[model samples]
Target chain A: MTQDETMISVRNIGKRFGSVVAVEDACFDIRRGEFFSLLGASGSGKTTVLRIMAGFEAATSGAIFIDGRQMDAVPPHQRPVNMVFQNYAIFPHLNVADNIGFGLRKLKLDPVERRRRIDEMLELIKLPGFGDRLADQLSGGQRQRVALARALVLQPKVLLLDEPLGALDKQLREQMQVELRALQRSIGVTFVLVTHDQEEALTLSDRIAVMADGRVLQVDTPAGLYERPCSRQVAGFVGNMNFLPARVVSQDGGSARIDVPGLQTTCSISAERLARFGSDISLAIRPERMTLHRERPADQANSVSGVLHDRMYLGERTQFQVALDDRGTTIAVSSSTTVAERLGSIDPGAQVWLSWSEEALIPLGND
Target chain B: MTVTSELNAPAGADKTAFAGLRRLFFQNESLRGLVLLTPTLVILSITVIVPFLLMGAMSLWTQIGFDYTDDWSFRNYGIILTEPLYTTLLLRSLGMSMAATLVTVMLAYPMAYFLAFHVQKNKLIWLIIITLPFWTSYLLRVFAWRVVLGYEGVINTGLMEIGLISEPLSFLLYSKSAVIITLAHAWAAFALLPIYVSLEKIDKSVLEASADLGEGPVMRFLRVILPLSMPGVIAGTFLMFIPTVGDYVTAALVGGPDSRMIGNLIELQFGTVDNWPMGAALAITMIISITMVGLLFMVLSRLLKRWVAA
Candidate 1:
């Protein structure tokens, strides 16, 4: 991305709360009009980074730059960003219209223009007739929409959302996720969301920064983070992966033949496919990448023999726990229910075969 | 549990009737509740209701030379309506209480706000400290104020010692301001508690939301904090003002002849003046007037709260 495409440049920001480190050396650039997300578990310091960007919390070191202007001296109210708090924080005393019009107060727009703006926002949030409804009268999903409309009515350059849909039911959360993406697209404003839910981050973001233990582990697109994560932390967080101990057998200029004793296979992996780290290297494979078969597949290079310990029939997929013959190490294998049905039923203690392509093996880094 | 048992008390119903009544007592929930409340009701009827009824009856009767007159009349109320002394003292008492209520609420608001927002530790200890003054007797508190505001009291003596005045300040005591100041001080805890409770009930995130919406600290307080804390403000005003309006002890101790209130006049009629009917009438009149003023205040405050929110 060019300089103009960069909307927010966070440079080495850190926050310490008196002997407790909250965020340390966080650095990332959010592109203009892009829906970016900071994905982490609780206590990963994602919220702290978003707060710093919104000017709610000042970083103990480094600074934040929005639209190429340093925001160190700016207060939250004066900053060009607005936040939708975790609890929505709808002013209880005010009705929906007044809540949305709150930030418009400082603008001092005429009455007609102000009403026009508020009505426009209400329409955009699909709450056109909810102007007279008080905060407490709103349902959870409606309150989430109203919060979005309130922040958007200010015409901020960036919108910060902190677990905006965490309070909604599962069904409502999925609906709001779709609507949130649509809203962000229509407005074409930079959106920086903080959430611990990896699925939400993947579905809503153009790029995600995975954080752990107050540190940003990696920043990548959803597909990139899942397929080519630079570290073990990002791989495990984004999706489920089984780690297999591997050793280097030989190395060429562009490929390395590694011995994965757990899979009972030796495969040649391209250099770009490995994130080699730690004293002993380990390779990761997604459960869905491995195919399970009753009979030995002929001429398959990456094949292993294991015993079927158990199987779980999920609605969309079937999960099998296979213990490899090498050391009785259990590795989870998942396949579509259709594929598992085609192979017939397999009982516990029955022999089975698991196979995968060389491209499925991803080497993880220790850090 | 059987409804038919009520219709059949039995032929030899002596013991059977008693047994049936006991079963009814155990079965009827509301009956048990009424029986449980009888003792409190009996005590209240004797101590509060019976005296109020007697006072109401006496307020309509004319007293003749200490002998009881059963004939009911409005002669005492007519006197109150015609006498300038009654209305003057009544209005003076109201004005003083209003002044006192205003001062108390204004002073207590900051203390309550500080307790709610700034003090992060030992909150209960601070609460106990503010209420520590109430551990002293009410009369002792009034006398302490007299010492602080008397002719040669703390303020006057300290000023004289500093050579700021040629003579002691007489206005410091035996004046309406003296009564107002003492009343404000004496009832401060009543004002502080309600204000503190209301302020504490406010969600801190609402204040942050206000700041995020581009309001500075002062505007946030005015727009958010003050309006949200109005319940406590209204409660504090009522607690301080209503009781002080009928307070005789404070006025008698610090107020001089000109600063005498309606409470003092009513006490005089019942005591040295030996006019029981007149005293009863004055008490009834004060109660009615305060009730009306309090209702008006409540309506106005509700309107103000809604207006500010709007």
Candidate 2:
């Protein structure tokens, strides 16, 4: 991206707490008006990266540029960035108006302008006339909005949010995820959110940089990352998957022929998707892609012989665990409507067939 | 119908009673908290409240020599208020204590701040060091201060050694300045601990958040640190000021007639004059004055809080 379009450029940024490296060699460019997310599990340095970008943490060695200005040595307050902390960090001593206008107060804005901005922020957050209430008086969702208003009122070039909705319950969390995305879009400022929740990241981010062990694993759109994971770890982290140990029997075009112990099957999987070449390579398949059959299908390349172990009846679908002959468990999800017909009222020990499309069997990295 | 169905059941009745009790406990958390703190309440009433009540009652009575009677009057209060000498002594004590508390706070604040936010390790060591002077005998410490501030004391000797002054400064000893210094030293621990506790209770993350909001170190200190530590500042001031007003030892050991505090005058009326009534009256006057000052400080603290909130 060009310098003008790129709101933040993190170059070789690293952070170390004594001998332990919290984040290492992290680099990324965030464009203006993009809703970007740093997705990772706990202790994966996503929060550390956001803090470094926000100038709350000093880089052990590296530099950050916000709007073409070096920010490695700049303190957090002087930077043109505001953060919505996981805990909200609303000034407990101040009411809603004061909390929202805290940064504005530092600007020496006229009282009328400050009040006007605070009122505008409150309305934008859908919390009109909440100025007189204490932060503790608000509910969880209200507090989250107040936090967002507090950051947005500053009109920062970049807004860093660290687990912004992690404190809410599941229902509210899901609702706020969409609300936050719309808010970010409406405000037209680059938003950098850090969260460990995969669904939250996928739902909110226009682009996501997946992190693991203080390193960026992949940077892609949410759909791209989900549909095309670069590694077995990323695939497992992003969604559930079933793996079958296989060896590459032959290679043709961009696809590979693989063999498994239980069946001499020639499954078509992409060669470029493989992380390593050896006698052992796992063919990763998602559970939703697998189909269960009562009787063996006439002709299927990627098919397995198994016995139906048990069935978990979810509201929308049913997940069946099939015990394969190779001592591996393969799970298959069928819609509740077709589950009974496909399985034919199967018991725990009924013999079954698990089959999937050729494109469903994606080769994964050795992890 | 369901309630009627379960009404005859013994299990349901027992469960309902237990649930009600649990709900009651949950609802009156303040009462439960007081119940949990019964030991503290009992100890405070025995050591503090009982003596205070007795003192208040004693202040209203007249005593004839060593005789005790049911007779009560405001004669002692009248004597204390009418006497300009006692009133002057009381005012002098208030001034001295106020100065000492202010000086102690000024010295303790930066030290407390450093210990709270700056120091990464061995914090307990620094705390002990700040409290080291108090570990020794209070009388010994006062006497030591007297010696140090004497005509041929360490300050004069050190100045002579440095060739800054040829002779000792006689005006420095046996005066209000000496009393102020001695009282400050005596109460330094009181001032430091409350301030330190307040500083320690401050959420470090709040300060970090303030800094992250674009405030410089000085502005953050003014806007966050000082305001947040106000409770401790008030606590430390009251902790030092209230007791210092009644202090007589430092005055006797180091102060002259002009520097004599309320405690010294009260002791004089009872000991030399053998007039318990006047002494009790003086004691009542001091208590009332100190009580008013303490109440005023509390109000001031509340007002400051509102201002900070604004």
Candidate 3:
């Protein structure tokens, strides 16, 4: 997105609580109408960055601009942003309609207009006739919807959600993930979600900023972040990445020849990798990208013979852990249930060969 | 087959009846609740209900000399209604109790809020300190207030030492305000705990949510904090008000002649006046008045909450 299209611009923002730094020198631009997520593990300062953007916290250094307006002196209430809190903080004393209409009171909307807006919000949240239901009486998912409606009713320039679906069960969470994405698309409002759930970030976000240790490590589209992580940390955090220690032999442009001790071969690394030549780098590959076969695959460029150490039968896929002969490093390989069934009776401790294309090998930075 | 079935029917009926009885009395929630409540109910009947009923009966009897006449009448009620002294004392008691409740709750809420929100370290220590006044006897606390508010007491003596006043303030001690002050201090602990509990139970995220929705500090407190804390406020108000209205000690100890409350009159009737029936009548009136006022306050608060939310 262009500079003028940036809805929220975070400029080298840093936050410190006493002696401990919560977030450090983070800078990014969230585009207008984009569903952006800050994804990280706990204590990784993702939520802190979201809070700073919402003006709930003051950054110790740097500045934040919402629609090009500096938000340093703006109080949270005055900022053109609203938040769906992690706990779904619906006012227990007020009914659903009152809770949703809380922010509109200051605007002095007429009674009929207020009712119309509340009804519109209720309908938008798929609770068309639940305006008078007591807040405490609703179930968890219903309360979440009410919280969303409450924030959306204000028509904020950006909506900040702090682990909004963290309290939900797995099935409900997945369902809400799709609903949240659809809701954002339909409204076309900028959404900044902070969550530690990698699957949630990948599913809901248009672009995800992977954060670690109070800093933004990488910001890219979900597929880009998963397919090509800049460092080993991001690669490991995003998905089930198998990292094998490797020594780069040589480099031609962005592509490199790397000697993977576990794979027992000099593999051709993809040109997309940014690692330097003759350096100790790590070869990372997604579990699903590698396939296991009982016989040696003559056509494959990268292949290793190993003993199948363990096998787990998931409903749709079977995960095989193979212990390579060289260095005795164990690598995980996954195949679809149908494929595993076709190659039947591949027992643990049986000899197997793991193979993948050269493009499947990802060269990651040592750190 | 018919004879055998007929013979077995009675035994089957008996088994079902026993099972039904067990379910009704033991397994059922409502019946089980009643059964569990029986002990407290019996105790309350003996300790509270019996005395109240007897007092109600006695209020109707007239006491002549040293004996209560068997002839039931409304003589004491008539005296209460017609006599300006009794009516004035009752009104004064209500006003003084309300003043004490208002002051106590106002002072206690901020202290409770501070304890609940501001103090992060050694909260148990602070709570114990807040309740430290309760360690002393209630009468002793009243006496302590007397010493502080006395003509030559702490305020007057300190003012004189500072050369701010040449004479002791006579109005500091034996007035309605003095009774109110003494009673509020006596009930401070009671007022603080309930309010503190309500404030503590408030979810911190709710405040943040309110702020995120564009409410400033003052509006946040009014729209969120105050409404949520109303239950404790109501509890604290009644806790202070009910007992203070019937309190005789503070008024007797610090009140002037003109500041005598209905409680003092009731105490007098029960003591030197030897008019037990009249005292009983006055006690019933106080109960009825306090209940009426309490209900009115509760209804008003409920309406106020609705209005505020709207």
Candidate 4:
């Protein structure tokens, strides 16, 4: 992103809780009008990073800048950022309008202006005529919207959301993901979301920062992170992945000779896919990229023969767990349409060959 | 929604009262609940409600041989209220109780808030220490204060030995201030526990939300913490005020003649003066006054809630 369009820049941020490091050397930039997400599991330091950016937590050793101004010493209340907490945290004593207008009340906005903005926000969140309703009277989705309206009504330079859809049901969560993104786009303010669901990050964010064990593994666009993972951890985290350990035998012209176990012939992977020679190498492929067939196909470059160990029939797709002769397990997910047309039917202990293009299999670094 | 509403409707308004009675006896969980609570209710009625009703009746009659069956009259109430000394003592007791409750709450709120929010893992230890005095006898606790504030006590002796005073202070143990100080120390835990429970039950995320929305610490406490804990404050004040008004030990032990509370006066009327009717009337008056003040607090809290919301 351009520096002029950068709204919040986190530089070398880290946090420690007693002897446990929560976030380590975390750095990312949020564009002025883009929705960015930090995706990780529990205890992966995603929330700690967001809290440091929001100034609720001070970084152990780094700086946070908003609009190019240093904010290391700024307290959370003084920072030009507002957060939509995971629990919605709507002030229970206040009605919906007062909750939405709470921050403006602190700014000493005119009473008439405050009322107008509160009404506008309630309508924006599609809760018109709900100003007098107590927060507990609202449904889960309504409370989430009220929280969103409250955070956005401040018109802060950056809007931080911590698992903003966590309280809603699955359908409501999906719906709010779209609505929240659309609202962010229309408001033209930078949005930073933190979630553990990679699909949520992919669906709602312009860029995703995948975190694990208090360290950021990679930060890229969702497609880039999924397609071009830099490490084994990222590949396994972002989607269903299959890894086959291999040894680099030779290299020439964007293709490399590799000895993949469970097959007699040495395979040729793209030389561009290689990280370094003599490293304990592994080939990574997404489950959806590999195809299954009952009989071997003619002239397919990378083909593996294995017995199907298990099969799962999801509503829209069929997943196969295949066991190789001398190697570990590999899984493949195929749509039901292919199950009807190509393979006809599937069962355990059936012989199958899994084939994929050389470029589809990404070679990941040991690090 | 229709199914749930139908299922939730109270059992058959169309049914006969006898059928309703049968349903209550045979089918209702609430009846079972009441059955389980019957013994406690019986005990409370015999120990508390029956005596309270008897006192209410006695307040309206002339006392004959410690009984109210002789004559029904409001003469005792009329005499008690008309007496300037009695009314002054009643008012003084009310004022002192109010002042003591105020001082106790003001001191307890910060300590409770600190324990609830800032003490973290060691909070239960601090709470136990705050409540440690209550495990001992109330009379012993009052006597302990005598040692702290007596003329030749630790405070006076230390000050005099340090050459800070030529004489031990006589004003420390027998004045109205002494009564208030003694009561405050004695009832400090009573006021702190309810407030602490209230503070502890509040969602810390709400405070975090306040700060996230740009509210300062003072503003957050005023707007969120204080109002949310009003129920506890109301409960603590009621807990302190009701018993303190009728407590004779603190007054008799720590107060001078002029500082004697309504409890001391009532005890004198019943024990020394042989005026049972007037003492009953005074007890009735004290109960009514406390009930009125408690109601006023409830109303004030409700009004404050509305005012803050508005």
Q: State the TM-score of the second chain for every model.
A: 0.88, 0.82, 0.90, 0.87
Highest lDDT against the true fold, candidate: 3
Candidate 3: what lDDT?
0.92
State which candidate, 3 or 4, has the greater TM-score: 3
lDDT of 4 by residue, B1-310 (tens): 9987787565555456668787778887888889889999999999999988887776676756655454778898888778899889998899888888999999999999899988869777897899999899999988998899999998999999999999999999888998999999899999999999999999988888989898888888878888889889989999999999888899899888778899998898789876777788899999999999889989998888767643
Candidate 1 stretches greater than 4 Å from native = A272-279, B1-46, B68-70
lDDT (Cα, tens digit) per residue for candidate 2, span B86-180: 78899999999999998999998998988988899999999889889878999999989877989889898888899999999877778999999
Q: Return the clash pairs for model 3, or none.
A: none
Candidate achieving higher lDDT, 2 or 4: 4
**Can you give the DockQ of every candidate in the order shown?**
0.52, 0.47, 0.66, 0.51
Number of clashing pairs, model 3? 0
| Tens digit per residue, CA lDDT, model 1, A1-367 | 7889999999999999998899999999999999999999999999999988877789999989999999999987788888888999888878999989887878889999999999999999898899999999999999988888889988889999999989999999999999999989988999999999999999999999999989999999999999987877888999888988888777788987888889878988776565345435778899999999898978567898899999999998999999999877899999999989998989999999999998888887655
Q: In model 1, which residue pairs have backbone atoms overlapping below 3 Å? A: none
Per residue, candidate 1 scores C-alpha lDDT tens digits across B265-290 of: 99998999888888999999998989
Q: TM-score of each candidate?
A: 0.92, 0.89, 0.93, 0.91
Error of 1 at A270 (Å): 2.8
| DockQ-based CAPRI category assigned to the predicted complex of candidate 2 | acceptable
Model 1 chain A worst lDDT run, 10 consecutive residues: A271-280
lDDT tens digits, residue span A79-193, model 4: 8999999998988888998899888867687889889999999889999999999988999999999998998899898999999888788999999998988898888888999
The candidate that wins on DockQ is 3
